[model samples]
Target: MELGQASAINFGDAVAAPQSGRRAQEPAADATADPGVIETSIPFRLDDLRWSGFHTRVVLALGITWVLDGLEVTLAGALSGALKASPTLRFSNLDVGLANSAYLFGAVLGALGFGWLTDRIGRRKLFFITLALYLTATAATALSWNVASYALFRFLTGAGIGGEYTAINSTIQELVPARYRGWTDLLINGSFWLGAAIGAGSAIVLLDPAVAGPDLGWRIAYGTGACLGLIVLVMRMWIPESPRWLMVHGHPDEAHAIVAEIERSATGHDRAQRAGTLPKIRLRMRDHTPLSEVVHTLFVTYRERALVGLTLMIAQAFFYNAIFFTFALVLTDFYHIPSDHVGWYILPFAAGNFLGPLLLGRLFDTLGRRTMITFTYGVSGVLLALTGYLFSIGVLDARTQTIAWMVIFFFASPAASAAYLTVSENFPLEVRALAIAVFYAVGTGIGGVAGPALFGALLDSGSRVSVFAGYLFGALLMVIAAVVASRYAVAAERKSLESVARPLATME
Candidate 1:
C-alpha cells in the first residue's frame, strides 16, 4: 500500500495493537512495540482523529492556553455593549477592535521572538516563560482602570500566548508520527474554540447587563481567562521535552532516556530500567549553507511547497479573521441586539469553528495536502460568498443569517488548520521553527491584524452600498486565496513527515 492509501484508517483507527499480547503487559517492551501513540492513523480511514500519548498531558496543557485564547478574542465582541456602559472606561467600538489588534501585535512579536527561542533554547523552557507572561498579563487585563491600560495588558497577554502558536503546533508536529499528524493537529487546534465557546457561554450568563453590574461583568469575564491561564501553567509541569528535539540537538543520551521513559510508562515497567533509552545516533544541525541559500531554497527547493505554505496561510488568516470578527459586527449592528444577546447569535459560529477542524483534518494524511486544500478552500470560498450575499441582501432573517454563517464557519475551519499541519511537516526539524515563524508572522500576525482593521474601516463608511462592498472585498480575497492554492499547492498527502521534508528533487 502507498503511504496514505491503506485499509480503513481514521483518526481513531487500530494502529495500537500489541506486538503480541505478551508485549502489551511488559513496560520495557513498549519501545519495541507500536510507539505509534504520537499518531495512530495509517493508510486512510473515513473518520480521522488524533490521540496523544507522549504529550497527552502537554496537549491538555496547551488546550488550557487556548481556553485563554478563546476567552480574550470572544469576550471583547461578546461584551462590547457592557464595556461601553462603563463610566470609567468610555470605550468606543473602534477602540475595542483596536484593542483586539493590540493583542495581535503582541502575538506577532511573540510568534517571531519566541519561535527563535524555540530554536535557540528549546520547547520545554520557552513553554513556561511564554505561559507565565500571558497569565500575568491576562490577570492585569482584568484590572485595567482605563482603555489604555486594558490595551496594554491585552497586548502583553497576546505576546505571551503568541509563543503558543509555535510551541504547541511545532512541538506536537515533531512529537507525533506522520500518519496521524493531520487530524491530531486539527483536533488540538480546535480545542482553542472549545475554550472560546466556554468563554462565550460564560459572558452571556455572567456579564449580561441585566444581571452582573456594568463594569464588574467585563472585569469578571477577563479575570476568568486569567484563572484558566494559571491552571494550564500547572498542568505543563509534567510534559517532557521532545525526544526528536533532543536527538537533533546532539543530546542522543537524553533523547534515548525520554524515549525509554515513554516506553516504560506505556508497557508498564520500572522507572529504573527506563534509563539510557535513545538510539546511538547523534545529529548536529549546523550546515554551512548561506542565509540567502536557505531563503532561496525554501522556494527554489520546492515551488509547490512555497505555494502551499503561503496560499493556505493567506486563505486561513484572511477568511478566518474576516468571517469570525465581521460576524460580531453583524450581530451588534444588523440585529441591533444588546452585547449579551450577541452571545446567543455567536453559538452557531462558535459551533462551526469547533467542528470544521475536526471534520477536514484527516484528509492531510489520506487524500493528500493538495486535494484537501483545493477541495476545502474551494468549498469554503463558495460558502463564504453565499454567506455574504445572504447578509448583504435580505435573503435571510437575522436568525437565519446566524445559522448560515455557522454552517460555513464550521466547514471552513478544518481546511484552515491543514495549512499549519502541512507547513510544519514539510520542513526538516532543522528549519521547522523558522519556516513556521515566517509563515505565521506574515499570515496570522499581519493577515490577522489587517483583516479586522480593513473590514472595520469599510463598515464605518456611511453608505449601505459601502457595507455590502466590504463583504465583497472579503469574498474576493478568499477567492484569490483559493486560486493561489490551486495553482501552487503540493500533494504531500500520503508521504511521511520525514519524506515530505526531503523534496522530490532530492528523492529523484
Candidate 2:
C-alpha cells in the first residue's frame, strides 16, 4: 500500500488485502489482542443498498429534527410582536431579537459539546439524548412566566436542535446510498421550510383573539412544537446505527451483521438477489486520535475542502438568519402587514424554498456538485441584490417584495441545503460529525448572530436604504461563497464518503 502526500491522501491503493468472496470469514476471538491499531475490511455494502420503505422511514424519522427547529425558530419570529404585547410577558423588540440570539447561542454550544460526543461515542446514543433535551426545553418554554425564563428555555431548545445537526447529517450520509445521498440531504434540510410554513399558520390561528386569548395562545404554540419531537422519537427508536461508524471503531462483525440485515430487508426475501456484491473496504482502526491529528486532517491534509465547507456554511448561515429572522419585522414595520396575516406571506415563501431542493436536487447527482452548487449560489445572490435594490427605491410593495423574495430563495434554499451536504460528505468518517459542528458553530456564530441583530436594528431605523444595505451584505457573502466553491468545492456528487475523503483508519 502507498499513502499519497498529505495534500491529498488517496485510498485507491491503500486496501492492503482483499478476500475472494463477497464476505470475509469471521476473525479470531483474540482480534483485540493489541488495541494500538487493528486492520479489517468491512465491505461498503450500504452504497449499493436498494431504496426501500426503510430508507423513507429513516429519512422521515431522523430528518424531523430540522423541521422541529424550523418550527421553533419561525414561531419565535412570527410571535415576536405578540410576546411584546402580552400582559404577562412584555418583551421589547430588542428582547425578542435577543431571545432568537439566545437560541442560536445555545445551538452553537450544543453543537460543540454534542458534536464531539457524537464522534467519540456513537450517532444513535447522542441523537436520542439530544432530541429528549429539545422536547423537554420546548415544552418548558410554553410555561415561561417572563423574558428570562423564555430566553433560557429557548437557549436549551436551540442546544438540542443544534446537536441534532451534527448527529443527523452524519447518520443520513453514512446510511443512504451514494446515489441518493445528495437528494436525501437536500430534501431533509429543505424540510425546515415545511416546518416554517406550519409554524406560520399555527401562530396565525393561535394568536387570534377568537381562537385563543393573547396570553394562552403563545404558550400553546411552544407546547405544540414539542409534540412533533415525540412522534419522531417513536420512529427513530426502530432505526439501526451507522454500520460505517461501527466498522471503523473495530466492530467489524457487528457492522457486517447490520449491513447484511439491511441488504436482506432491501431485497425482501429474494434468495439470489440478496447476495449482492459490496465494496471490500480496508479500515485501520485506532482507539483514539488526538485532537491535534484531527485538526491536522482538516486544515493540513484536506485544506482546500475545509475552505469550501466553511465558505458554504458561513455564507448560508448569514444569508438565512438575516432574512428569515427579520422577515416578519419587515412585513409588519415596513409594509404594515398585520402580524396574524404574516403567515399568508410565509406560505408562498416556504413553498418556493421546499420546491427548490425537491426540484433541483437530482441535478446535483447528475450534473455534479461543483457546477450545480455554484449555479444555485451565484444565481440566488445576484437575484437577492436585485430584490434589495428594488425594495430600496420603493419599487416593491409588500406583495411584490414577497414575490421577489420567493424568487431569490427558490435558488438559495437548495444552495443552503447543499452547504450542509458539502460539510458532511467532504470530511473523513472519524471526525465527520465534529467537522460539521465546528464549521456550523463558527459559521452560525459569526453569520447567524450578526445577521439577525444587524437586520433587526436596520428594520427599526425605518430607513429603506439602510435595510437594503443589510440585504446587499448578505448577497455579497453568498456571491463570495459561490466564487470560493467554484474554485475549491469537491466533485463528489455520486461518490462514496470513503472515496471523497478516505477514512482516517485507512493507512499505508
**lDDT per residue, candidate 2, 1-508, as tens digits?**
2222121112221212212212333244323233333343333457766798878888999888889988998898888878877899997767777888889989999998999899888899998999999999999999999999999999999999999999999999999989899999999999999899889889988988889877888899988899988888888888888878877775555665676677678877532222223334445654455789889988999999889988988899999988998888888888988777788888898899999999999999999899989999999899999999989999878899889889999999999999999999999999999999998998999989777777877877899999889989989999999999899899998887888888888765
Q: Any residue pairs clashing in model 2, and if so which?
A: none
Best by lDDT: 2
Error of 2 at 440 (Å): 0.6
lDDT score of model 2? 0.83
> Tens digits of per-residue lDDT for model 1 on 1-508?
2223222222122122222322113333223332222121211110111343544665677656666777778886677677777887877666766777788788888988887777556778888998889879988987899989988998998888778777777777766555666777777777768776877887888766577888888888888887877777788887778655554454434554565566555445533322222111112222122446557766677567767687778667767775565556666666677777777777667888878777767866687766666777777778777777766666777788878877776767777777777777777655566567767777876568777666666655634456566566656656676677777776656445544664211211
Q: What lDDT does candidate 2 reach at residue 168?
A: 96
RMSD, every candidate, angstroms: 8.4, 4.9
- Model 2 poorest ten-residue lDDT run: 7-16
TM-score of 2: 0.92
